[model samples]
Target: MAPRRCPCGTGLTYDGCCGRLHDGTATAGTAEQLMRSRYSAFAVGDPAYLLATWHSSTRPGRLELDPDVRWTGLEVLGTTGGSLLAAEGTVAFRASRLDDGVPGVQAEDSRFVREGGRWVYLDGVPLR
Candidate 1:
């Protein structure tokens, strides 16, 4: 398969967007970077990276990907307190997708926590 593109439709390629980070070239030094990379992982079906980046406490054993769903784009609206060594943080964004005969968006405010010197995705609290 060809390399994936970011959900943001940047046309820059996933490697340029987040693959590099997941591949270990560029580390997600900030919460925002980690958040974007996580989104890119989802778009590319890289569940291993997702599981690896998720906090162990909250990490699930599997990520269930719907076969009919296609993630369209990612629009990160904002983030707060994701600085290095912070205990916790939040990322707010809009993730667009097409699934089950419907095209729509999942606007969410996701939470994260720093553990063992890394940031891990916890879950999201949707904001309508």
Candidate 2:
């Protein structure tokens, strides 16, 4: 993934947006916070973080980053209960991307699960 503007419309890289959260930062105190950082991680092509935060049961074996793709912004549309001790939860959002050729959005109703003290992304329902 190429470096690109953040949701704030700043030229700063996504690594600068929420990468800190994945790097031992204590900024993420809630599921929503973690969700935002995960989005930023996707934007920055930080598969390591994505995997680390993912619950082992649902985590994929690997991630393939698109060299030509760039993430533009993320919008958290809604979030339902997913308590710190809960086994499952959901989040709805829209993630915009560009391939240096065409632009598109990935709207999803994402599912999550808590294992130990971490929240891992499960599958999601894509909303075109």
Top of the candidates by lDDT: 1
For candidate 1, lDDT tens digit of each residue in 1-128? 98777655557787787878778787777777788888777777777888889988888978877777778888888898888767788989998888876898989998888777777888888877
lDDT of 2 by residue, 1-128 (tens): 78755543335654565656667664444566667778877776788888888878778899887878888877888888766656677888888899886898889988877667667777789876
Clash pairs for candidate 1 = none
> Which of the numbered candidates is closest to the native, going by highest TM-score?
1
Query: Model 1 segments beyond 4 Å from truth?
Result: 1-5, 8-12
Range of the 10 consecutive residues with the lowest summed lDDT in candidate 1: 3-12
Clashing pairs in 2: none
